[model samples]
Target: MRLLGIVGWTFCAALLAACGGNGDKVNTPGPVTPGQSSASISSNTAVSSLSRSSNNSSLSSGAMVMTCASVEGAVFIDETCPNWQEPSVFEQQKVNSNIYYEVPFGSDGALVSQKIIDSGDALYKKVWDIQYNNNNDFNGLPHFRAAAAFPAGVDMSAYATGKLIFDIKVLASPEANPDFTVHIECGWPCYSTDVRIPIDELNTWKTYELSVADLIRDGLKITNVAMGFQIIPRWGQQTNTHFQIDNIRWVKGSAPVTTKKCFAQHFDRTDWSYTTKVETVDQMPLDSSKWLAGVGPLVTLIPQWNSVGAAWGFSVRDTETLSSCAAKGTLSVSVLLPSAYVDDGQMQLGFYFISRSGLYYILDGIPASRLKADEWNTISTTIPAGKISNAEYMGVYFDSKGSNVANGYILLDNFVITHSLVQ
Candidate 1:
C-alpha cells in the first residue's frame, strides 16, 4: 500500500476544486432535477486524475524531488535535496566497493563518538567506529541510527542469487551480549524484516553473510534499492555501546529457494462489524450499526448520501492479521453494484490498513469501470514490498462521485491476501 497522506490530500483538493471553494471551505452544490443530464451532474463534482511513476519526469508536482550529483555507475550522494544534509567529517569517502559510508545521527546528547580510522590489519584498511550513550532522559532513553543510501537506486536484478556480506566487531558494551539490527530498505515504508545481530564475544572481528533471497522474501525490492541498509541499536537498554564495522559488499552466490503461505477472509460470517463516517442530507445522524449486514452469505454496505453528492460507504474490519503477509502479493475484494447507481467516472473503491501508530496505508482506488453493475467484480491492488507488521486494522472504502441519487448500496465479499515466506 502507498502512503495515504498524499492520496488523501489530492482527493480533498479535487473535491474542493469541483465544489468551487477555497481551502477548508466547501460549497454546497445545488439540487439536481430529474431532467438534468448525467454530464451536467458530473460537471459539478468531477475529480481530476492523478498518476505516479518511477521515472523522474512522470512524478507529480507534489512528489518529493531528489537532486543526485553522483553519476549512475558511482555511489549516490546528494547535498542539495531538502531531506539530505551535507556529509560530516566522520563520514567515510566512497571506495570501489558497494558500501558508501553515511553520517550517523542519534537522540539529543546520545551520540558519544563517530569516526573513520585506519585498521591495523593488512587486508582491511579502514573501519567505522560508532559509540553512543542510551541512558539519556529523552523518552527515558536515547537511540542511534546510521544508513547507507542509494539516492539514484541500483538495479540489483543481476545479483538476485547473491549474498550481502559484512564484517563487524563489538569493541565495548554494557551488556555481555550486544544486540543491534540491520534493515534493508527499498524506500519509505519499504523495508525488510529486522535482521538481528547479537555479539557474544567482544574485540573479535567476525564476518556475516545474509542471502539476497531471504531479504527479498522479507520484503526487500532488489530492482530499485533506494537504501542498501540501515543500522539501528535496540531500544529500552540504558547503557553505553560501541562497535566497529567494515567490508560491506554484495557477492554473487547461490541461495536456497523459498515458498509462500497465504491467508484470506471470505466475509461470510455473521459476527462481522463495521464503522461508518458518512455525510447525510441536512447532516442528519446515522446509525453505524445498521450500515452493514451479512446477507446471502455476503457482506453488504449501505452509504448515507449528502445533498452535495458526497458519500462514504461502510469500512469493514478484518478479524485476522493478514496485513503482515501482504508483501509480494495482492489485496483483493469482490463488489457488486446496482444498475441504479449511475457511473459518474469519479467513483473510487479500494482497501486500507491502519498501523498501530495511526499511520494509514491506502491503495489507490479502482476506477468505476472495475465495478460492474448488477454483477460481481473482483478489484485488486498490488501490495508493495514494505514493513506493515504494525497494521492493526484492515478495511474497505468507497468514495462516490457527485450523484444526487439516494437508496444506493453495494455487496462485498472475498477479501484475500497472499505472500511469500522463507522456509
Candidate 2:
C-alpha cells in the first residue's frame, strides 16, 4: 500500500525517541510522606478565601464550587481563581510562579481557539473554553499540550502516595473519539507514560484522578519536579474537538476503584492475508505481490525501490471486526532483518497501522541499532480505543525508510492484537 505523506521521517524519529524510548537513568528520590509540602501557591487572595469542606469547598461568601473536591491536604495548581475578567496566570511557557505553558510542538496547522466562559448562572464562576481545528491539514500528527511548571523545582515527594486530580468536560468531538494524556515532567526526556483520559467518560463534567506513584514508576521524578502537571491529546486526534478543564490539583488519597479488564488476542498465520499494489517507474510496471510470500509462520517482505527516494512496503489485513476490544490496543509483530541491511544502516524499518477510519498510525522509528541482526525482533504500536472500536479491517504494515538498500528482505511472524475492556 502507498504510505501517506503525513509525517516526515526526521520528525517521527525524534517523537519516538522522546515519547517512550529508554534514556539515561537518574537517581531515584528518597522516601516521602503523604502530606508533606511539595508545591508553591500564588498569593492570590481569591484562592486563600476558599473554605475547605469534607466533600467540596466554596468561597467564604458561600459561592458555589464547581470542582469535584477541594478538601484539606490538597495543593491547588490552577483553580481558575480571581474570576475570568482578570489576566490569566497561564502562558505558553514557564516564566514565574503559579504559571504554565504549552509545549508548542507544531500542531500540524491545527488552530487552537480559546475563551473564558463565565458561568455565573451555573455552579462555577468561570472556566477555560478551548477548541481545536486541524484546518484540513493532516500531514503531521498534531500535539496539544498544557504543561504547568514549578518554580525552583518543588519537592513533590509528599504526593508520591496521593493522586493528581483534575476536572474535564468534552463538549464536542469527531466521529472517531479521541482522549488526552496526563504527564509529570522532570526535565527533558524525563516524563511519565501517557495516562489517557477514559474515552467513555465525556460530554459531562467529571473528576479524573491519576496515581502519583504510577507516574513515578514510569520515570517521573517527583523530588525535583520541574513541570508538575500537563495535559496532552493522544495521536490520531486530527479532527475538530472542543473541551473544558478546571480545578487542577493534587490531593492526598488513592483514586477510586473501577472495574476494567484488558486482554490480548493473538492472530494465527491463517488470520492474515497478503496485499500489494502495482507501481509504475520509468515507464515500467512492477507488482510487489509477485515478490512477497506468506508461508507457515513466516511472511517475507521485499521492498521495491522503483525510483530514487521511493518508499513502499508489504501489507497484510484481517477483516475481523474487533469492535469489542475497545479502551486501548497494541499490535505487535516479529521482524527479522537481513544481515546486509543491518550492517549497511542505510535504510530503516518502521511499523505502521491502518485504523478503521483509514488513518495511518506509525510507530516510533526502528533504528538498526535497536534490531538484532539475523534475529527476530518484536515490533509494536498502540491503537486508540476509539479507532479500535470502529475497526472493521485490522492489519500490519512494514514501511522502509530510505531507498539505498533495495535488495535485502525482512521476515515477519507472530501477529497479535492486545487490548483492555471495561467489563
Candidate 3:
C-alpha cells in the first residue's frame, strides 16, 4: 500500500553513514534500548560497554577500556561492506564528507559527489593536481578538498581518541596570503576548535595533526557530536584562494566490529505521509514531495507467517552483502503491545540466521511480556557464532500464534543487521 501520496520531488543519494539528513530515523526493534546497537562483546572486558545512550536518540562512546578485539558498530562504516561492518580498523578515514555523489568512491566504497553544500562565491575544484609536493608521506592520495570546500556537521566523534590527520597544499592564488581555518566539532553541544593556516605554510604540502581529545579538553564528550566537521576558508574575498586538502581522516587505535544500520521503517513519523510496509530500500513508497530529498530503499518484512513460512526476511543488495560480515551477530527490534494484549500474556520474538547452505540458526525466544504496554520498547540479543559461520542472510521469524490469535500484532522497526567486515 503506497499510502503516502506525492508531496514533493527532490532527492539526494541515500548513503546513511555520511548522510546529511535523509530524515530516516533508524530504530532498534529488539528488546534492548533504542540506539544501543553494537556488536556482541564480552561483558568481562575491561570496558563493559561501548554504546550511544542517545536517550533513545543517539549519543557517543564514553572513555572505554583500551584492550578489545573490535567494537561492533564502530564509528566508521565501511562504505563498501554490505553488512556495514569494517573488516579492519580505519587508521585514517579520508575526509569525503559530502558523499552526495552520482557514484561511490574511495577504498571504503563510500558514495562520492562534488558537493552537498554550496561554497558561496568561493571557487573550488576536486583535484589530484597539487599534491604540491607535500612533505608528509600521504597514506591515501589523489583526492583532496580544494578551494572553499566546507562540509558541514560531519560525524568523526567515533574516532574521538584518534588524531585529526591531514595534509594541505597551496596553489599560490592571486588572493594575497590566502589561508583557511578548519573547524572540527565534538558532542551534541558542538564543542569545536579551528586551526589557522599561515601563508608561509600554504606554499608547500605538509601533514598536520590535531588531538581529538585536546579539542574536547575542557572535559567535553566526543563520543557523540553535535556537529561533526567544517572547514571555512577566509582569504582575499571574491579572490578565490586556491588550496587543497589531502587525506583528511581520523587515525584510530584499533579495529572493532561494526554494524551499519538503516531504517527499514519508523511508523513514528507524525507530520508527513509514510509507506507502512516495505521489504527493501527500493520499495520505500514515500511522499517524494515532503521527501524532496529522495529516500533510500525501504527495509520491510512480512508480518505474515502462515503460507509465507518466513515472518521477516531481507534480500541483500549491492550495497549490502553476506560478505565478510558474520564474526559478531546482532538482532534488535522495537515493539508495542496494548493493554488487552498484555492481558493474554506474552508473545515470542525469534531472531535467526539463514545461511547460504540453507541452514537455520535461531536464537532463544524473546517474550513479548518484556515489551511495554502501548509504548514502544526495544529488545536485543547476541547471535551465537559458529551456527551462523556461513550466514547468507539474517532476520526475525515468529510463529503465527502472535499474528493469528494474539490480541495484537508485533510491531517491528529499526531492523538492525550485523556481519563481520573482516573474515
lDDT of each: 0.44, 0.42, 0.33
Q: What is the TM-score (0 to 1) of candidate 2?
A: 0.38
Give the clash count for each candidate.
Answer: 0, 2, 48
Candidate 3 on 307-415: residue-level lDDT in tens? 3112332322111343234445544544344654445453344444444444444455444444445443444555444444554444543432334433234434334
lDDT of 2 at 41: 13
| Predicted candidate 1 versus true structure: per-residue lDDT over 177-209, tens digit per residue | 766666565653344445556566787777655
CA shift at 64, candidate 3, in angstroms? 26
After aligning candidate 2 to the native by TM-score, how far in Å is the CA of 85 from where it should be? Answer: 17
Model 3 bad stretches (over 4 Å): 1-152, 156-323, 333-343, 400-411, 417-423
What TM-score does candidate 3 get on C-alpha atoms?
Answer: 0.32
Poorest 10 consecutive residues of model 3 by lDDT?
45-54
Tell me model 2's lDDT, rounded to 2 decimals. 0.42
Minimal lDDT window, size 10, model 1: 14-23
**On a 0 to 100 scale, what is the lDDT of residue 377 in model 3?**
41
TM-score for each of the candidates:
0.38, 0.38, 0.32
Please give the distance, in angstroms, between residue 211's alpha carbon in candidate 3 and its true position after superposition.
23
The Cα error of candidate 2 at residue 339, in Å, is: 27
